[model samples]
Target: MALLRDMTLGQYIPGESFVHRLDPRTKIIVTMLLIILLFLVETFQGYGLIALFIGGLILLARLSPRFVLRGIRPMLVIILFTLVLHVFLSEGEIIGQLGPLKVTKEGLFKGGMMVTRLLLLIIGASLLTLTTSPIALTDGIEAILSPGKRFGLPAHELAMMMTIALRFIPTLLEEMDKITKAQMARGADFETGNIVQRAKSLLPLLVPLFVSAFRRADELAVAMEARCYRGGEGRTKMKQLLFTGRDYAVISLTLTFAVIVGSLF
Candidate 1:
């Protein structure tokens, strides 16, 4: 699978790496801050620093260097489209010409900036999911959003839903793959139809997928009910997350980096 080869996002790899050891809440907070900084930055210098930040994280996480490259490679179309949009629409001094279009010096720089921001954001966000388990991620989200409960927000439910959706991605993909193979074995042509016909053919595939999803959901609900499951009102975590000296050390370093970058550019 392309995903198995490239995007490790949302797939937890077990290790004793420092990144794997940090509190999930710390990783979540750090990732959030990095994403905010990505959007707020505009200068090339700023992007350079961000690049270094994310690059360091990839190294620190002990993820494959191939992974960082692969993460960006599949998204090349999106980055190129973003660059092209900026090139045609941005107004500036005409530096050169591309066919019937004009290329502005500012547009090129802006395109570079846009592409860098998007790449970093994707890689950073993916790293969080890669290093943290779905359960840990859900707990972190609930903990961070717990204050919203006073405003009647369903923080715990939302967290559970999000984590479940992520956890289901690989499961659903495998299911679809199996279905496609079986259909092919039966001479169900999914590839020989015209665009519209192909679209129609997909109906057979989707019907089974939806049915499987619902069946699994029902099984999960019944299992939870059987175990006397309730809402988050007074639920106690079997493995309660706690911040240690390492967590504070990581947070302190993140704050320091944020301040330094903000001041520099």
Candidate 2:
């Protein structure tokens, strides 16, 4: 599927822009705050403001608009499904009807709101990963979770697990693509069928993909053990994270973004 290649999770784009230069921790925290703001955005005005905010950030990061938005393509089905569910299931003044289901104004409003929220969250996270390397993201997460160590939480381990999972998304997708192509080359029919037939055809694809994933996991575990890896106890970082004036500038910018959306929007 061409869609697999468009999935940009956990990948980084190298750049010399201000966004790429900001500390990973700063990006993580600011992105978290923006998500909180996204939830509170209820009005079309709010949506417009957020659109501008995300658009500006995308441009600032020197990212291609098409590339960044490409990740959303695969999610269209789920988005439409949610919209339809809301249209049929939610109650209010019925503005239209599709067979037995009634589409209400409130449902339309909510469906649009739900779409906006998902889009904002998706785009925001994509922007973060697009600008920050996976290693830097791991470091940022560990730093954020370090405070939980006082409560006996395995912060470093948790961060490492999260990082590994995020990092594997693209890798595993690529592996599946390769496997699919290989199978197709051998005359395995995947595209010439009805819905059920096509689904059955994918059974051959999934088995190899899962086997490859488990094998990779086993190899990773063995490699870690060979290096004498244990839990995150007594771990030391090579590069100590420090907040600088630029990081504070990020804070100011986030605050400005909030005010712009909340007040003017």
Candidate 3:
């Protein structure tokens, strides 16, 4: 469940561009809208439209495609695996058969659709994270959950936990990488071992990581209490959130697009 704490989005880089200035809530909402529309899209033409729309977003955010691709590089292997499985194993009207395996037009179409859907999901969500700051994202979450706090929902506490978790993801990843290397240098043999042996090799790395994470949590809790930190109650924001004309324009466009895509399917 480390991902429960880890931020999947890219490290937020603050800029004075049009994207950075939009209200966090608006950004979050638009991102959700985009993802929903992405799944709603059925035809290949619809997917193309979504791709162009996302490209426009990346352009608006002023981020390089190289950097965005870097964020998704780690996921490519899994995506490829999925694509391969879908392409080879799926059953359809026989286009060819060899050694108990069949390749067909339906299989090809299904596999291509799966791969395309996955790519759209990953890239679209990555765009959201690439453009939004952690603090702003947390604030957006808290604002969305504000109403639930009236029923003792612990909205602020959850947000605080998420904030700490997001903040430490990179640090923990570096630590894990270092720990892995250190174990390797000690003849841990993680790579060459059988599945069970490889799994066993991870214990040396994981125990210390868990211990360190627990210690950090304890220290952070103490530090928060020492500073008289409380929940979101009665706390005023340093920056007031406001929706701009650009936000309205983006939302209207997304909603319209979503309706069109739904109708197309």
Candidate 4:
């Protein structure tokens, strides 16, 4: 469950700096462009450039690398498990041989590459959310999806739901954490048990969490209706976002990076 919390999909740290000030739409576009560029990075030189670029963004965001790495700590076990599995299962000319296991240079090379890619992808995206707010990210998502509304898509409504959901993730996680602590206080033991017993202990934790989540949803629905919240029609933003020169510069630099990385292929 802690690993689930560490997924980093919707985790947003609050900030008011320049990166935080950019329109959500601009940030989403720029982030996606950078991620796409990452796939184009193959050679060590390309990876080095990508590292430098992301490092610069980290500095600009004023976020500690330690915090970013902390978000990835829970996944370290899975990463190592994967690397080990790939190294042993992959067939190649034997680099070393034990009693029943064989190791190959090719296997180690491929597994290492896979793990590195996973680390970079997670850390890179985490950097985006670490510097941006959930509201801003949702707003950006809605802005980017607005054009789809013309094709009979409920883009605004979808975005609104997503925004609200993202806004609640941390709150819900905190709630779950508290609930788990309460259950533990009542003699619910998650550790020191077999797999089945450990899983069963989760039941007590989950039941109250689900019931409370439902109650919250019902209350939110009632509140939304009380506010006469209709769909996207006749809605106006109190603080409409406008992109500036810096936004364009960021986008242009992202595009140039893409081109340079693409040339490496």
lDDT by candidate, in order shown:
0.84, 0.86, 0.79, 0.79
Query: What does candidate 3's lDDT look like per residue over 1-265, in tens digits?
Result: 3443333456676677777777788888888888888777777888888888888888888988777666556677788888778777887788887777778777788778877878878878887777788888888888878799889888888888889987888788888888888888887876776899878878999998999889888998899889877767677889667778988988888888878876886
Model 1, TM vs. native = 0.90
**What is candidate 3's CA lDDT for residue 259?**
83
| Best first by lDDT, ranked | 2, 1, 4, 3
Error of 1 at 222 (Å): 2.1
What tens digits encode model 4's per-residue C-alpha lDDT throughout 1-265? 6667666655677877777777777778877877787676666677677777877877777777888778778778889998998888789888898878888887788788777767777778888787777766767777888898889888788878987787677778999899989988898888978999889889998899899999999999899989998888999888677889988888888788778876874
TM-score of 2: 0.81
Q: What ranges in model 3 sit over 4 Å off? A: 1-8, 150-153, 170-192
Between prediction 2 and prediction 4, the one with superior lDDT is 2
State the lDDT of candidate 2 residue by residue for 1-265, as single tens digits: 6665667865689889989988999999889878988887789889877888889989989999999988787788988898888877899999998799899999989998898888888899999999998888889988998899999888888888887787788798788889889999999998797999999999989999999889999999999889878878766778887888999998888878886776655
**Would you give me the overall lDDT of model 2?**
0.86
Off by over 4 Å in 1: 1-5
lDDT of 1: 0.84
After TM-score superposition, the amount by which residue 219's alpha carbon in candidate 3 deviates from its true location, in angstroms, is 2.0
How would you order the candidates by TM-score, starting with the best?
1, 4, 3, 2
lDDT of 3 at 247: 83
